[model samples]
Target chain A: MRSYLSRTTAIIGMGLLWLAALIEIYPIILVVFSAVKSKPELAVNPFGFPKEITFQFFATAYDTMHYFRSVSNTVLIACVSVVLSAAMTSMAAYAIVRRKNRFHSFLYMLFLAGMIIPFQMTMIPLYKMMVDLGLYNSYHGIMMIYLALTAPFSVFLLVGFIKSVPRELEEAALIDGCGIFQTFFRIVLPLLKPALTTLCVLNLFSVWNDFLMPVLFLPDDKKMTITVQISKFQGMYSNDWSLLFAGICMIVLPMVVIYLLAQRFIINGITAGAIKG
Target chain B: MQTNLRQKWKINGIWLLFVLPALLFYLIFLLLPTLSATYYSLTDWDGVTSTFIGLDNFRAMFQDRLILASFRNTLQYTVSITIVQNGLGLLAALLLVRAFRGVNALRTMFFMPHIFSGLVMGYVWGFILEPNIGALNNVLEFLHLDALKMSWLGDPSVARWMIVFVSSWQNLGFSMVIYIAGLQGVPRDLYEYSDVEGASRWRKFASITFPLIAPSFTINMILCLIGNLKLFDQIYSLTGGGPGFATESIASTIYKVGFYNGIEWGYGSALSIVLFLCILLLSVTMVTLLRRREVEM
Candidate 1:
């Protein structure tokens, strides 16, 4: 009787998880279904499959939203910001971990302090500065801001990973007459690949999906990133459910593809960061 | 040797070089803006003007009804969503801890919502909750439950709760994942020993499982509090603080006051300073409290 009860409980647990999964995935499926339906059909059959699938909504959303331009802008910003942030963070981490000076700990703590302050606190003044600097609608301005905002956590993560590298490896390279920069580039960095990949994926997702920063700082139509572009599309096409879903599908597809491709690393990176914190 | 001294200097200089780029970016972008926000909070400079009136911005903030409304709304959303999300997450974790076939796949599916962007999820759910042609209302109508088909995102009373529900749905997966990790870390031997001693399942869970996952509870609570406190993207895309200022949060209010409405720069800065202090103090207090509990355990 005990064994039977345990089995039944297990079955019920599995049922609950399945229900949760269905709820989690329902929106994505609904968005796709709505994206293909005509306007009248979407209103008529909100939950059912479309009787006829047409590509017109996709065409309209694409044209009105300027989907290609927004995609390029998002890709450019995320890529450039990730590269700059990774390089800067890793280099700084290398210095702090290897040198182990009094000032190093102080600086590390300063970066960690940045993590506690919410970004909302910085938005107002940052917007004012951007306008004053004549970078209110420029790609470089947004990219630079992202680089700065992402640097602290990237630095924190890299510092923890870099500290784990054996000192003997660096010492051996130094004994062989390799310079400090040479040691970092050739010997130390190669061993830090796992951490590097993790940071790259994490930073990529954040920079790509970020809406608030781009909305405030890059509000100009031509300079908008994907998230801001989608917001604009929603604002304009608020009554047109099909078109809105198409826009959502366009914005979500790339991230979904990327996540599927690097699921394991992404999972590891998130769990590692959480458990360590 | 003299050569060794020169080598040491070069290494130190190179180390400084390595730190320069990140430091330069942080100083110019983050530190400068944060400090300027503090300085601007003391003034009455509109965003476009050069004039300053010291401390008037903050003095005005205390008198503004909209600011007070936003503070209340933000606190309401944060506290409710944090409690519900964490509660549901813990329940889900408890259920998932018992081994079953296809459990790993179930875990992945449960976590999938967390991986999606909050903006996308908000928009998707916005469609789902629309009163006229939303799937939710249609389902309710088909079920012959007309009384249950109230305006989900349109009514002031219901809108805040709807936002809470969406926020919980988006975040519960993350909390569940954390709890699962915590649950797995608890040794199985404790459960077995309790079973041998004829402890009921409830007693074993209360005694063994609860204390062990105290650290997880602390971490999850702190993260949920901070994340919900700074909520903007989801609220922005979903409601835009609509139905007559019923759902305006601190971040939304700051954005409106600063950029959208009329660029009240000093006022916005004052609000930002208040938010920063609230987050800072809350986080410190929470960490201290949680750490103290961990020690007691």
Candidate 2:
């Protein structure tokens, strides 16, 4: 009886895992396979291996979406914004945490309040601000907006991580003749690598995959990011399943590749991000 | 005493120097926008013109059918995503607790979708659930289950559910990862004690595992609530608030009303302020309620 019970439980576990694996990958598999199949094959063999595979769709999508420019625009925007948020927020969080004053709590509430305020509330004014700044369709304008949007969360996350760091080390660094900026850059920043990485990767994903800001700010196709580019493609190719399949794949594949390569860091980064903060 | 006061001022001055850049960005990008919402929401501001319109915008907002439905849909999306995402996450954490072959690969596959923007993910699902040539129906036909092969995005009810499903699928890995971390932190001794007492697996989890991971529960719940309430990208990419106002959330509606063609600047402002309030109220209440539960235990 005991042997039978153990076997039953083990089988059930495997079944559950299989169901989950399907749930996780079903749509994605359809997407991957759809990209490779001809339009006729997609309708006939949607769940099966592609009857004939071709890279034609990818080539088509690459040109249609202006893939190179969009990727560059996305990378440029994500990189600059993340770097700015990291440098600016980490320094601010460090100052706030180290002060040990009422101002820290006041700043905390301010950030927490900022967190609850949706972008929609201020999006109009922000768009107008971008227009007035002569950056409505430029990369720098979008980059500045992203930096502003993500800063509060980054500051909040780092503040939590910063509190857990003992001040004794920083004091010792100060005693060893390191200035405050030097202590922060050389000592505290090193200790914050894990949290910093978490913040950067998370920020990178948000900025890279962002649609609303890019659609609104970078209205010009030349300035458009990949997400917005494909969205526009979807509109043009709404009826053309074959071309749309390839377009979606072109947009999704790079991120999927990046995630696969950096799976360990990505998972570890977010885990630390959540558990500590 | 005078020297102490001077020293305090000097310390503040030094710290403020370090934080100035961040504060400047926050003042312009975040704080300014938040404060400006009040003025815009109450006025007849349409980019080129501005006039104080009092509560007229708010009054018009309540009578707007699409706005009402959008707010209702937003609430439903939040509640459903929170419960389902957390429930599935806890289950994944439980299953993955015991190390097995391909565990790492499974976790990676699960998390891979989340890295994509929700808009792209929506488009991916849009093709899969596209009625005639869609993968979902294609499979149903092959299985001879043609009755189940409904146009997934056609019906109002089914369209919203598909949005929820796609959102949950994309976000499951995030919730699961957090829960697994929470599970790892639950002390092994408690489980050992339960085992010694011959308690059932479910009972052990109920009595110990669940309570210990209460903090993760709170964090995950708050994150989902805030994120879903502010949802825009998925609805935009998937349904476009369509088949005639079926799956519209306020986030999507705001963009449509404000920027789609002729901008209803003041009306959109009022719509978003309402969204902001809903998020603030719901999140604060949830955190307090969940924290109370944690203390009660």
Candidate 3:
């Protein structure tokens, strides 16, 4: 009798989770379905499979949103900015971690404090600065903004990781007649892989999906990132739900694919960053 | 001693070289703007020219009805989102603790939303909640629950709730992941110990599991609180603070006033400063309260 009751409870638990799972993916499923369905089909069979699978919606979305150009721009911008931000911040973190001095400690605290100051506080002046520098629509300008915006957390994360690294590794590098840059490029960076990977994945998701910097700085359609392009598309094509679905799917596909491919790394990296904080 | 001093100066220079780029970026992009926000808040700056106005912007904020409504709505959002995300997350984490077949797939699906930006998720939900031929209302009609179907974003009262719901849906997976980590930190032996002694599941959870995961609770709450307080991307895409400022948050209002509207940059800075103060106060208070509890535990 007890076994029967326990079995029933287990079944109920499984059933509840299944319902939650369905709810979680239901919107996503509808979205993917909308990507292929025509406007008439979408209106008629909002939740059902499309009667005719039209590839034209995706093509129209691609041309309208400039998906190819915007995607490559997003990728390049994220990659370049992440590389610069990671390099600079990791170097700063290495110095702060290894060189124990009052100045370095103050510097560490400064970067730490930067994390809490809301970006809204900086947005206005940053916009003006970008315009004044003739960098409003430039890729490098956006990259610089990203580097600045992301530095604090990247520094904090790297500082924590670098502190855990043994001092002897650096001392040995020095003894081997390695330059400071070489030491960092060779020994420290390779060692900082896990933390760097965490920062990289986090930054990729953020920078690619970044809207404010892109919206304010990269106003030109030719220079816009995927997120900015989609927002612009949404604003103009508000009534075109079918096209919106296609554009959104295009925007979401890379992120979803990356997440699926690197789920474990992404999860572990994020969890580590969280608990460490 | 002279040689040692020279070596120290030389080593410090090299170290400073490594630190220069990050220092320059932070100073230029972050520190300068933050300091200027305070300065700009005092002046009637329009990005081109400025005149010292001396707290007029601040005074104006207290009289602004939109600001007040946004504050109320944002506070409501922060409180509700924090509770629901953490509660639902904890429930999911607890249930999923014992891995079964397809647990990994379910976990992946749940967390898929977390991978995308809030902008995308908000846009996605914006369609799902559409009044006519939207998936949500369609589901309601199909189930013969037509009464529950309302204009999700059209109604003022309903819009804020819908924003809250979308924000929660987007972030719940994150909270769940955090809680799962917390749960895993709780040793398996405690559950085994309770099992041998035949403690009720609820009792075991309350006595052992809850206390063990208190740190996770603190982390999740603090994160959710800060994120919701600075809410913008989702609101920007989802509602644009509309159906007549129903779902407007202070963050969104700042954007509307400063960026989109392009007239009230000084006033925007003042409001942004206020929002920062709120976040700082809440975070500091939460840390203090939670830390005190943690020590007692």
Top-DockQ candidate index:
3
Tell me the spans in candidate 3 whose CA falls farther than 4 Å from its real position: B195-198
Q: Which is the winner by lDDT between candidate 1 and candidate 3?
A: 3
lDDT of 2 at A78: 92
Ranking by lDDT: 3, 1, 2
Q: In candidate 2, what are the lDDT values of residues A37-141, reduced to their tens digit? A: 887787677677888898898898889889899898889899999998999999999988888779877876776577778988888878888898898999888
RMSD of 1: 1.9
Please report, in order, the local distance difference test score of every candidate based on alpha carbons.
Answer: 0.85, 0.85, 0.86
Q: How much does each candidate deviate at the interface, measured as C-alpha RMSD after superposition?
A: 1.4, 1.5, 1.3
Model 2 lDDT on a 0 to 1 scale? 0.85
Root-mean-square deviation (CA) per prediction: 1.9, 1.8, 1.6
What docking tier does model 3 reach? Answer: medium
> TM-score rank, highest first?
3, 2, 1
Estimate, for each residue in A83-128, the C-alpha lDDT of model 1 and write its tens digit. Answer: 8899888999898887788989888988878887778778888887
Residue ranges of candidate 2 with Cα displaced over 4 Å: B1-11
Question: Which portions of model 1 miss their true places by more than 4 Å?
Answer: A1-6, B1-7, B97-99
Q: Regarding TM-score, does 1 or 3 come out ahead?
A: 3
| Each model's DockQ score | 0.70, 0.70, 0.74
Q: What digit string (tens of lDDT, one per residue) describes model 2 on residues B1-297?
A: 999999988867878888888888888877887778778999988888889999999999889888889989998898898888889888988888668887877777676678888988888788788887777898888889999999899999899988888898889889999898899998989888888999998899899999998988888998899999988888998899998998999999889888995778888888888888888888889989998998998
Question: How many clashes (backbone atoms < 3 Å, residues ≥3 apart in a chain or on different chains) does model 2 have?
Answer: 0
* Model 2 CAPRI rating: medium
